[model samples]
Target chain A: MKRTPLYEEHIRNNGRMIEFFGWELPVYYSSIKEEAMAIRQKVGLFDVSHMGEIFVTGEDAEEFINYIITNSTFQKEDHSIVYSLMCDKKGFAVDDLLVYKFNKKHFLLVVNASNADKDHKWLLENRKDFNIDIQNRSKEYALIAVQGPRSIELINGFFPIDVAALKYYWFAESTFNDNDCLISRTGYTGEQGFELLIHRDHAVRAWNALLDKGKNHGILPCGLGARDLLRIEVGFPLYGHELNEKINPIEANLGWVIKLDKECDFIGKENLKEFKEKLSRKRIGFIMDRSKIAREDSVIMDQEEHRIGSVTSGTFSFCLKRSIGMGIIEKKYIDIGKLKINIGEKIFTAEITHLPFVKIKN
Target chain B: MVEVQDSLLYAPSHEWIRIEGDIGIIGITDFAQSQLGDIVYIELPETDENIFMNSAFGSIESVKTVSELIAPVNGNIIETNEELAASPELINKDPYNNGWLIKIKIEDKKQIEGLLSPGDYEDMISGGNE
Candidate 1:
């Protein structure tokens, strides 16, 4: 199993290490629910070094990225990040990623750790005649996220640049403890936060520094378990669960990121246009009546027990104090208000609700 | 740092039974509850329901995963813990005492002899050869 640079730090902090996608990472340091609540109320830090970072640099980098992703990168300013999905020629999702536009000649793609190899292969397969160089920088950098309502308080003045001045979705190249790094106001949690990308050699020092400085602000080290629950609460589509090679962005309720009529044609524009016009399945959130948590692949049925779709993700939302989940259901059956979820031999009643089980002010 | 009571008998699957006359008070061990993390929901069999040894009686759902509650011995469910429906974290807080799942009327006294001793159960969990 692959180990991150901060593996020893995690061990020292008493993190319960577990195998995740062939990587040994911490599931939680203290408790999963408590760590999640800390992110919601105070502040939390996470070792996101397992995420992949691939750099695309050359004269035609912008044009190459535009043709690869569904979202239009035409007018996106430099140092800004755009959340988009990469789809295959058949309009199904290859992977969902964040595109960091450093400039017209240089761009960075931060992708899921599980999809790193597959995404790199896809990028190479589509690099037919573009004058761009694709470099997989997954091992060169480590990612640390400081997230929550009090995240700004903990991050401000830590670097030479005014971190508070950094706008949302924008990044600034700065030095941390004399090490070159990039600080971006981006995170998976809905709360305010920043994702700092530093060299792998300096990650352990930076993590310890942040913990020491954040002692007064009540910052807790979180794990992948809490991170998963937090994203589910915010209705973010996980790559393998809510999306895959067969599920398109339109079916996953991510159509807002796809721009079909852009000046530069993308790989899946034509098929995506057809899918947009004839939508079939739609992703929706539902809340269970009781504490019966609906898990992934739990069958969804109508009042008469007719099959509609199945659950993509589910968990007990610590903030809402109830069970919530997202599922891809037939568009025709989404308005039935209440649906039945089959878990084991028992059937649970779920009330259809909008995406995001909880509301975030920021 | 899991606690094991010397007076109780343990199942291989981590359920513990405190024998009191013909009534066996059954609940999960400390190691089992800790492994499951924060318990959010628990499904227990109804009162008077017949349950067999080594069969799944219900389930326990945590934040990230779900685990089936395996029965340790054949018996009739005389009473099920009702408080866990609203507050399932009780198992995480006190798995041996307030977190007891069910009270069963033992069908055969010979079945109790087959259960593991507290020391053996502790050894199995602590990576000792059992």
Candidate 2:
């Protein structure tokens, strides 16, 4: 299994290490509830170095990026990021990613760890007639996310820039303890948060420094488990769980990221437009009774025991203190009736709720 | 580190039973509680329900995963822990005492003999030299 640079640091902090997508990462430093609660109530740090980063440069960088991702990028100013996805010609998601426009000539794509190689190869294959240089620089950088309502204040205290005022989805190149770093005001948690991207060698130092500096504010080192729970509470779509090659953005409730009227025709524009017209299944949220904890791949059913769809992700919610899940179900039943989830041989009753299961502090 | 009570008998799946005359007070072991993390909710069988040895009578739900509660001895449930419905975190805070789940009327005391001793349960938890 691959180990991030902060592997030993996580171990030292009593993180329960687990294999996540072939990377030896922590599931939780303490318990999932305490760590997750810390993120919601105070602040928490996460080792996100396992994510993949790729750089696109040269003269035609803007056009190359515009041709692939679903979101519009040509009008984006420098030092801004767009949450977007790359889709196949069939309108299925290749991967969801954050496209960072560094300047007019350079762009950075932060992608899912599992889809790194596939995304790189896909970009290379589609580089025909475009003067762009694509390089997979995933190994050259490490990422750390400081999230929660207090995250901005804590980060702004130590960093040179006034990051608390940084607009959402904007980033700036700065230094921490003399090491050059890039900090972005973006996160999966439904709080004012930031993800600090730095050189691989500086990961451990930066992690410890943040923890030490923010200790008084009750900053704890959280792990993937809390991250998953936090994201699910806010209705964020995780790639393998809530998205995949067969699930398009429209079905995933991510159509807001797709720009159909942009000047440049993206890879899946026409196909996605057609899929939107014939939409059958829609991603929706469900809140289960306290007795059952729905999980991934659990079959979804109506109250009458007829199968409707399958759960993409589910958990015993730490925020709400109940069982909550997200599933892609038939659009017809999303409004009409109650839903149930089949886990093992047991069936659990649930109700359809709106997008986010928990209200954001913001 | 997991705490184990030497006087109590342990099931391989981490439930513990303390024999008290003809009664067996049952709860999840400390190792079990730590593994399950914070207990958010619990589903348990009703009082007077007969549960066979090594069979699931209920289930425990934590923030991360869920585990079935297996009966350690053949018995009829005398009383279920009703406090857990309102304060599930008691299982994590004190798995042995305040977090005790049920008191059962033991059908046959010999059923306790098949359960693991504290030392054997420790070996199982410590990975049994494998």
Candidate 3:
């Protein structure tokens, strides 16, 4: 299994280690509920170094990126980030990623760790006649996320520039202790947070320094287990669970990112447009009446036992103290009737609610 | 270090049984609760249900995953934990006392002898050579 640069730090902190996507990472240091609550209530630090980073540079970098992703990058300013999805010809997602634009000739793509190689291969296969260089820099970078209500105050003075001035989905190039770094106001926790992208060599020092500075702010080192619960509570889509090669962005409720009428046509524009016209399934969030969690692959049925869809992601939300889940069901049955989730031999009563089980000011 | 009661009998599956006359009070051990982290929900068997030895009588759901609560011996369920319905974290806080799962009428007294002693259970969890 691959270990991150902060593996030793995790061990010293007594983080309960687990295997995640072939990476030896921490599931939690104390407990999942404590870490998750810390992130929601106070502040928490996460070593998300397992995330994949790729650099795209060349004269046609903007054109190539615009050609590949569903979101348009034509009018996007430099140093801004665009959350987009790359799709195949059949409108299925290649991967959902954050595109950081440096200029018309340079861009950075932060992708899922498990799909890093596959995304690199897909990009290479579709380069065709575009003049661009795609470099998979997954191994050279370490990503740290500091999130919560107190995250801004914790990270404001740590950087050379003012991180509080950075708007959402925007990044600023700065130096961390004289080392090059990129501070982006982006995170998956649905809180006011920042993702600091630095080299792997400086990851250990950076993590330790943050913990030292965050000592008074009640900062705790969280793990992937809390991260998963946080994202699910906010209705975010995980790569393998909420999305896959066969699931398109439209079906995943990411239609806002699909710019069908952009100046330059993307890879799956035609197919995606047809899919939008003939939409069949839609993603929705549900909360169980009981405390029982409805996990992935659990079948969703109507009160009469007619199968409608399957759960994509589910967990016990510490914020709400209830079991919440997201699923894709037939569009016609969305608000028509009640839904039940089948777990093993038991059927749980679930009520369809709006996306994002938890609401945050940010 | 996990705490184990010397007066109780343990199953290899990490459940403990306190035998009193013909009744057995069953609950998961400290080691099992620690391994499970914070339990959110526990599926308890209904009263009057017959659970066979070495079979799953119920299940426990923690934040991470679900684990079956295997029966230590054949028994008939007489009562279930009522407090766990509102608060499952009790299992993690006190696995042996207030976190007890079920009370059963023991079917066979010989099965208690087949269970592990406190020393053997501790050794099994501590990675000691049996």
Candidate 4:
């Protein structure tokens, strides 16, 4: 399996390694519960170098990207980032990504690790009349996400600039450790954090430097296990589980990113407009009666044992001290009520609840 | 920490059976609890249920995954651990003594020889075959 630069560091820290998206990534260090709680209370760092980074440059970069993605890319200024999804002709989501407008001619798209190659091929095949060059620079860059409430304090301790002034979804290119790097105010966890993109060779040095500098802030080396739980707790959608080629952006509750009235014809606009008017499946949250957590692909059933939908993601939420899950059910079964989830031979009773079961008050 | 007395017979599945007269008190080993990492739910088998050797009696759910509890001996379960139905973490906190899963009436004394010794079970787990 492919290994990141911090693979040795993860082994040294006694991290349990698991294969994720063809890459050997750390699942946890001491315990998943401890690592998850650390991120919620203090600062935590993650080695997210496996996420794909594709560079789009040339005269027609913005126009090409705007035509492909389901977000208003033309309105975004340089050094801004917008969460978007690439859809097929049927308005079904291929992948959800972050489009970074680096400059007028250059744009970077960060995609899910497993869908990197597929997304790249799709972009190339659809680049029929657009004048743009797409380059897969995933192997050239390493990403680190330092997240939590005290993340700014840890970052400002080493960097010279005021990171607090950088608003959300904004990025700036700066020099760190004598190398040029891009720092962005974006993170998956629902907290104040930054994502740093640096050269691949300097990955270990930057990771160790941050660990050394942020030792006092209780910054621990988190892994994909904590990352999944944190994102789920905030009601964020994972690509393969919550989104896929069969589900559309509207069904995933990401309609805000789909701009249909922009006066320009784009891919999947017509189908999405029709879907927005008549959505059949809706995404909702469910809370299990006990700690018997439902998992992805588990069948969601009504009181009469009729299969209405399926669970997309489920886990024993540490913050809520119960089991919670997200599911896509038919609109007929979308009422705010109770339901049953079949987990193996047992059927767990669940109540239809709002997304984000645990809300952190600011 | 629960005590693992020398009088108890250990199973490779990390279950320990303490024979008291004709009754056998069963619980998971301390090593099993550590490996499971925080038990969240325990599904206990019903009382008076006949369990076959090496077959699944019930299941234990943790934060990461669920593990089936294999019956170490062929016997009839007389009593189940009712308290664990509400507080499953007792299995982690005291896997040997207080977290006992059930009380079974031993059906055969010949099955005792088939079980592993403490040293043998320790060597099997520490060999890192899992």
**What is the C-alpha lDDT profile of model 3 across B10-29, one tens digit per residue?**
99999999999999999999
lDDT of 3 at A289: 93
Model 2 chain A worst lDDT window (10 residues): A286-295
Look at candidate 4 and tell me the lDDT of residue A320.
75
**CA lDDT of every candidate:** 0.92, 0.89, 0.92, 0.86
User: In candidate 1, how many clashes are counted?
Assistant: 0
Per-prediction DockQ comes to 0.81, 0.66, 0.80, 0.58
Error of 1 at A218 (Å): 2.0
Docking class of 1: high
In candidate 4, stretches whose alpha carbon ends up further than 4 angstroms from where it belongs are B1-8, B128-130
True contacts kept of each: 0.84, 0.68, 0.68, 0.42
lDDT of 2 by residue, B1-130 (tens): 9899988999998999999999999999999998888788788899999998989999998867888999999999999999999788899999999999999999999888899999999999998932
Q: What alpha-carbon RMSD in Å does predicted model 2 have with respect to the real structure?
A: 1.5
Residue range A1-362, candidate 1, lDDT tens digits: 99999999999999999998888999999899999999999999999999999999998999999999999777989899999999999998888999999899999999999989989999999998999999999999999999999999998877999999888999999989989999999999888999999999999999999999988888899999999999999999999999976567899989999998787989988899998999999999999998788989999999998889999999999789899999999999879999999987689899999988877887
Pairs with steric clashes in candidate 4 = none
B69: Cα error in model 3, Å: 1.0
i-RMSD values for every candidate model: 0.9, 1.9, 0.7, 1.4
User: On lDDT, who's better, 1 or 4?
Assistant: 1
